[model samples]
Target: MEKLNWIAVDWGTSHLRVWLMDDQSKVLQHLASDRGMSSLKPEEYEATLIEMVGDALPDQGSIPVICCGMAGSRQGWAEAPYGKAPCTPPSIDAATRVSTKVSRISVFILPGIKQLPAADVMRGEETQIAGFLAENSDFDGVICLPGTHCKWVHISAGEVVSFRTFMTGELFALICGSSVLRHSVDDEGWDAEAFDAAVSDAISRPAAIAGNLFSIRAESLLSGLSAAAARSRISGLLIGIELAAARPYWLGQDVVIVGESGIASAYEVGLIQQGAMARRVTAENMTLNGLRAAHAKMVEIAQ
Candidate 1:
């Protein structure tokens, strides 16, 4: 096997994570930066990247860099294109890389995935899905990535056939932070009963959710529903709707929820209520693994 050192990056809207690997692809060191896509301009991207990886750069020709996440979006350093749905391992490998300079080092940005007219898009999660597939190559089913903007992906025969994006987390944040419900709820603490009740209400009468949202404030004014309870209600309602939308795809399929423990638990609860079997998998390192897989493929092609 040809020997090469690699730098892996998973840069998102609010944070940047970098990893250094030797020829065998074992991680040597990792670094993080707050200079994420949301805060940096195009011209400053190179300087920001070099600042994070400068000390780790190998003396050889530019270390091959593989990256995933919002770093490839329109607001990112370079506007890397999106790979449409029905993507397979080979199709992901066929994605074009974005080249940029960081002093003497060359950088390559991976393209995000998109399926148009449906208003669905993904940046960082695609790589994580790739990594998940790499490790569990035999599994074929539906993968649910829960986050600020959750993703529901269908994988079969080593390809991602179709996926959808849900704004569950974002909506939760909006309702909790800016809406009238904010005044009624506390951010800390989880109410299982309230959450379950809201999920049941939503699944049973999803159309009633919109009207009930106003009741959070109305009840607070009339019957005095606790602020925290109102907040949890809103969360349950949004997540419930997400589950309803995703039900069609997940029906009769094995479901894996890729996210941290807390969020995964919430999704699992919702899924269970809807008669779906769901499992939670840790995703902290999935992005790095996926980037490494992509970098390995690039090396093979170069050879």
Candidate 2:
């Protein structure tokens, strides 16, 4: 326990990921919980950290805990003010230090990046971007992060040039689970052919989206479209529309899709279908790596 150098945390909306680390940046232990920022009160954050990592803390001394994500949001444990765009990822020195009741630990949360005029903001994804840039420092292109609100970020010279967000994922859930399309859609099965065709169709005729979504229900009722086709079509159409709007950001450029296999693959596949050079990379350990990068600077600054 005395060998513990510092701690790393990726605190997001729906989950909390912690890593116990030594000076070498190697993880000695890992822990997680569904107790995300959304579920925690500001006052409870200090106790929550102790409760989660008490077993692993060193017996006597205080340890630095570097964190990234919603935990630094205005409503989170501490409000880590956002750094404007056209800048590198937030560094450890810029982290917001949260005052704690426990002397055995200190918490520092990273700030996210915000773009002006567009009024766009990101929290947890910044960590992943930092991790990506750590390995591919010279990368200059677009990074597509797919989730409830998908984000398309432009990177150049190690800076977040600009970004835009889409609501395709959330829209998919709402239309398929709570809207009129519910009766026509199934969450399980997928039709690859239907999905591919829909992506192409939507990319070519984006304005058709308003009419196409409702067509899923009509097709299911009249033409007897299978539930699998309906579900896949909806997904393809929504993602396709996003690709259409984001075409200017991609087109002949190379794009890196950073996320889990499922959603990341969808973006890669969709972009490829549109003739864009797209590839998928798993998000495992990227957050931790990003935190490690920040912690490195933190250690140096402290010294």
Cα shift from native, residue 136, model 2 (Å): 0.9
TM-score of each: 0.90, 0.94
Those runs of model 1 whose alpha carbons end farther than 4 Å from true positions after fitting are 1-4, 89-99, 116-119, 222-224
Q: TM-score: which candidate is best?
A: 2
lDDT of 1 at 151: 92
The lDDT, on a scale of 0 to 1, for candidate 2 is 0.88
Best by lDDT: 2
lDDT of 1 by residue, 1-303 (tens): 133387888888888888888888888887888888989887887788788777766566777777778887887878778887777633236554555655446577777777766768888888888888889998889999988899999999888788899889888888889987788888787778888999888877889877979888899888988766787788888888888878887789999999978788989999988888888888767777788788788788779
Write down the lDDT of every candidate, Cα atoms only. Answer: 0.81, 0.88
By summed lDDT, the worst window of 10 consecutive residues in model 1 runs over 89-98
> Using alpha carbons, what is the TM-score of model 2?
0.94
